[model samples]
Target chain A: MPITTCVFDAYGTLFDVNAAAAQAADDPDFPRLADLWPAVARDWRRKQLEYTWLRAVADRHCDFWQVTQDGLDWALAAQGLDDPALRARLLALYRQLPTYAEVPAMLAALKARGLTTAILSNGSPDMLNAAVASAGIAPQLDAILSVETVGVFKPHARVYDLVGAQFGCAKDEVLFVSSNGWDAAGAAGYGFRTIWVNRAGDPPDRLYADPHHTLGNLVSIPDLL
Target chain B: MPITTCVFDAYGTLFDVNAAAAQAADDPDFPRLADLWPAVARDWRRKQLEYTWLRAVADRHCDFWQVTQDGLDWALAAQGLDDPALRARLLALYRQLPTYAEVPAMLAALKARGLTTAILSNGSPDMLNAAVASAGIAPQLDAILSVETVGVFKPHARVYDLVGAQFGCAKDEVLFVSSNGWDAAGAAGYGFRTIWVNRAGDPPDRLYADPHHTLGNLVSIPDLL
Candidate 1:
């Protein structure tokens, strides 16, 4: 299958999830919140993925925002934080997370090549739009896809199918790029040629599906495609 | 449904994933590897969950060890640590991970209360055994269930089903506990009473499957149950 379209996962792939949390750490109201940010982000991301998968399996559906909030609440309490105002501020910042330095340029490069570019993420449509708009990268995207459409999360074949269904292509015809190793493996197993954007210098998960390519960041994606 | 039993997630839930890396940091041959351990463990865990779901969706199966190694390799490369010996030592440490201080006494309390105790983990049977044996917590478990039996990972209905299957009870009869908020939600959604062991002081995931209880750590589980 020819790869004519490129789909990216949002959170860790295009957006810096920790950026908002890191910013909030410096807030006057919550000095210790900064040290707690990464763990919060990690817990949120982990919960977000788990919610998507569980809902997918149970055939239940909810927007990513609800899941994101749930994740945040759990994280805050786990950290022994009870300040409602601080929680609210951190979450608001999350809504406007920044894009990684390489993201906009990569998206632009893909667009200049006349290839269809979109975001296939666990994020809700509104969240996706907000992120793309906030990051100033919406103009580079041809479409923004969310798992909400399929009522499932990534690594689920049905969710991946939504991307192919949208683009009018088979799964194999799309290049799925994500900073998440699992999503890369899931997309690969679903038959998409995957590129793992190893942003955090993390490892590839061997047990799932293997990526067709691994890159330091999205900066190298254009050459691979 | 009444919570007759409390099943715990291993790894980050009951074990200190960072302790091994912190210990390895003291090694002269791999000074920086220790610093990289937390990131490595995080990535590996993320991939482990990803692989379990991907394989479950794809109907592809491999043990957790393979997944662990795959995640390690990716983490190593991302951190620019290519030394074979360092990688081996780190991976070996994972098998013999130490339990959290509160684990044994908590398990004893659960057992003392005549409640069933088990481990519902993404770890393969072998890995679980090694961890249990190394931590000297093996005798405390009524059962050590792995996703290997179901050919899937946590947050999956089938993996949760294994718990009921082992105990000859309905899923709702079990009280599933995990440090991972999403897993708590998944298991809760699956009909088990759930507890979120918020060891890192993280927030609730705002899942449809909210836990029956939220705790800072396993130290208080016996009292709650």
Candidate 2:
């Protein structure tokens, strides 16, 4: 079958996780955060994804919200700066992250082209909803999916199965997009056509199938087909 | 029944992965390697482990040797240094990488106490055999196990099953040891009594289960039980 639907990874793909750290600059409590935020954000996102995979492998499922908080706490401790206010503010920022400017336009363009577009993420339903609504991109998406329904994280086959189940389409007919190369590899290995948004220019993850398409940002996604 | 068998993760736990890159300091071609080797080794090991997990999740299993080489290649590219002879020499160094100072004595103590000892690692059979023989610790082990039998990497339940299957013991009757906190978590989650060798003073991986015992190195393993 020809491609009929597009599924995106929520965190790094559709939402900018580092944007939450930018809010730290306004907080006088974290004087060093302006310079440290980038590394902290990277560590937090790495731990978040790692926790999801660890929990899945251990047969212990926690919502992505808890994982996100745990990841933030780890990142803070690793950086050796502890402030209750800064912690709370950073987490609050996560609930409403900024998106790539091309996100809404791309989703709209996909819909306009008659392609069904949805998000397939390890994020919790509440987290996804708040992020989508806060970014003003909720109205443009056909569906907002979360791993909570299945109680496992992405890169797991069952997580990918949720997309086909939702849209009633074959795996190959659903186009998967993720900024995370590991997630892209997993989706492609699961039989979806994957577009890896390598915004950071990292090497391809060598453990899984390579993504079908590679692009720098969401600006190129609408024209990917 | 009480724990009867002790299994160890080979690469970082028993053998020093960094030792290979340190050998590069002896090479005339890479004179700047002394300071660069540690960071390069860290990146290489990180990518190697990530590939193992990603491969396991993607159902695209390859032997650990390939993963190790792929990881080293990526680390080299990231460092923007390319030399075929340097790569070959580094890989050759891996087959006889240095072991922890206390490993042989600890294994001897376990044997003298009439406890069974073995190695449960992601290493390929040849790599494990060569390392154990070179370290003069092969006679100390009753079994040399690999993930090849299970076709997956650690943290996957099946890989842990290889240990129990070889020893004909229940999961709880086996004690697993690893320097990697993530590996310890997987063993604990799989129902084995775990000892995390925290030689680097790193924080525990905030993933799932915690190890049953924590020690600075193999020097503490014999006294653990």
Candidate 3:
């Protein structure tokens, strides 16, 4: 089926999840974090994704806000950093994660092509709103759907079902994009045409599902169509 | 109902997942992996659990063997190692992972106390069987259940139901032990009397389910009983 809607994952796909830690490197209170922030950010993002999946499986639903904080807690404790001020700064940066260089133009390109664009993310409404507005892409998005509505995180069929439910389209009519391999796999397995934003050049998962396209960045997404 | 079944997650609970990499360090092929093996094993283990959960959510079930290999693949590439010889050696070591020092005695203690002990794990049947026999814990275990039976990994209520269905007991009558905080939370949320091994001294997760026991090792299990 021809695609009518394009749904993107917010974190890592549109927003740079590493921006908070990268920015924290310059903070005067934790100047030494420059050496460790990269690893901390990697651990934080890993745990964040793991928490969402765990909650989905356990049937214990928490908004992405709680999971994000939980992830930051793990990251800080793992790195032996106990600065409350640093934690607050990192979280504040997370709420307004910077957009990737190509995000605005890519979303605008999709809009110019006469396609409806939305965000189907594990992010909470508040987090998504804060990010979209801060990133200055709010005017380009038709909808910002968070997993909070269904009380489950991504990769779950119900979580992806919201796209069609909100946009009034069939599952096949939505083109899904995500930097996360699992999200791409899940969306494809659910029958959406998936494009994996292979930002890290990671190998594809050996899982049953395969992404229809593996692009390096969001700017290339419009070209895929 | 009185506790009748004692189910354990096999990987980190009874077996040292790190031993495979540690042992591989002794191999003449890859001495350099010694310093990096710890982190590699950690990454491999992290990704393995992730693939299981992601597959469970995506409704794209693959056996844990493939998932294990996928995890290893990610770790290997992440560390810039591209040797097929090293990969083979690691897989061989993993197939017969060494058991934790306290595993046999702990399982025997439970059996002597008249409890039917089993392993309810995300490991495939072949993987679980090989590890059980190679680790010499097979004689003490009444059953070795794999996620293959339900075609979904743990943290899912259906996977936990295998324990009760096999033992003909209520959910509360099962005591589930896992070193993974998320698994402990999921099993506890599903009504098992969960004990988190807490091997790494990690802080408790803020998930809704709280483990009934936070013990340091399997040796402490009998004391808890």
Candidate 4:
């Protein structure tokens, strides 16, 4: 089936999840974080995803914002760094994560192709909105579907159901894109034509399914169409 | 309610998850793996749990043995090592992982107290059986429940339901112990009085619920009574 809708994951796929800590490290105020930010950012993103999956399986549904904070707290504690001000700054930065350099043109190219574009993310509505608005690509998106609507997280089948609910597209008629290998794999298992934008050249996740395509970044996403 | 049943997560809780890799590292035939084994073991365990949670959320059920191999593959590839012989050796070792020092005595202690002792694990029947028989703790355990029965992994509610189905015990009447902080949290959220065996002294997982007790090892488990 031809792709009718192009769906993207919000945090690491469209926005730079590493921006918060990287930005904090660059700021003159947080000198101590200069050497520690990368590890912290990696941990923050890892724990955030882990919490979402754990909560989903455990039937404990919470919004992404709380999960994000919980993740940051764990990341900070792991590093033995306990500065509340740094925590606040890192979270505030996460609220408006900078989009990748090619995000605007990539979304615009998909839109120009007359394909429906949207985001299906574990992010809460407020966080997704803040990110979309900050990146100024809200106009290009037909919908921003958050797992909050279903009170669960990916790679839950219900979370993937949001795409069909919003666009009324068949599973195979959607091109699901995510930077997370497991997310792409889950979408594939759910029967979507999936693309994994493997920015770090990480190995494919050992999951039930594999993405149909693997690209180095979103820059070539439009080309795949 | 008093604890009538004592259920433990088998792999890391009773069995030392690192034993396979650590043992492999000690073998003279694998002298090159001495420095690399620890990171490989950590990645293997992390990916194994991540796959379980992902598969559970995605509704793609596979046996734990496959998950174990997949995890080991990822870990091996991450370290840029590829040897079919080494891979086979690791899987062989995993089938008979050593139980923690205190597991046999602890189960014996629980049995002496007339508490119904059992294992609730993601391990498949054959794997769990192999480990149980190898450890000679088959006589100590009243029941061994695997997620294969439910076709999903923890911390799914259904996985926990197996405990009650087998033991006929109330959630509050069971003491759920796990080395995984998340598993402990999941059990706690499921209404079990949970104990987190924090052997590594890691911080508590930032989940909806927290384990009721934290201990350095399982040796003191009977002391709680």
TM-score of chain A of 1: 0.94
Best by TM-score: 4
lDDT of 1: 0.79
Model 2, position A49, has a per-residue lDDT of 76
Question: Would candidate 4 be rated incorrect, acceptable, medium or high by CAPRI criteria?
Answer: high
lDDT of 3 by residue, B92-140 (tens): 8899999899888988999999989999999999999999989998989
Q: On a 0 to 1 TM-score scale, where does candidate 1 land against the true structure?
A: 0.75
Clashing pairs in 3: none
Rank list by DockQ: 4, 3, 2, 1
Candidate 3 residues A94-181, lDDT tens each? 9999999988998899899999999999999999999999999998999999988988888989988898889889988889999988
What is the DockQ of the complex in model 1? 0.38
lDDT of each structure?
Answer: 0.79, 0.86, 0.89, 0.92
What TM-score does each prediction get for chain A alone?
0.94, 0.97, 0.98, 0.98
**Candidate 1 on B14-68: residue-level lDDT in tens?**
8887676677778998987656777766665666566555665555768878877
Please provide, for model 4 over B101-153, each residue's C-alpha lDDT reduced to its tens digit, 9 standing for 90 to 100: 98899999999999999999999999999999999999999999999998989
User: Which candidate number maximizes DockQ?
Assistant: 4
- Order of candidates by TM-score, top first? 4, 2, 3, 1
Two-chain DockQ for each candidate model: 0.38, 0.51, 0.59, 0.83
Local accuracy of candidate 2 as per-residue lDDT tens digits, A104-177? 89998998899998998988998999999899987778899888888888788888999878989999899999
DockQ of 2: 0.51
The residue-level lDDT of candidate 2 at A32 comes to 84
- Expressed as tens digits, the lDDT of each residue in B110-218 for candidate 2 is 9998899999999999999999999999889999999888787888888898887888988888999999988998899889999999998876778778899888888
The TM-score measured for candidate 4 stands at: 0.97
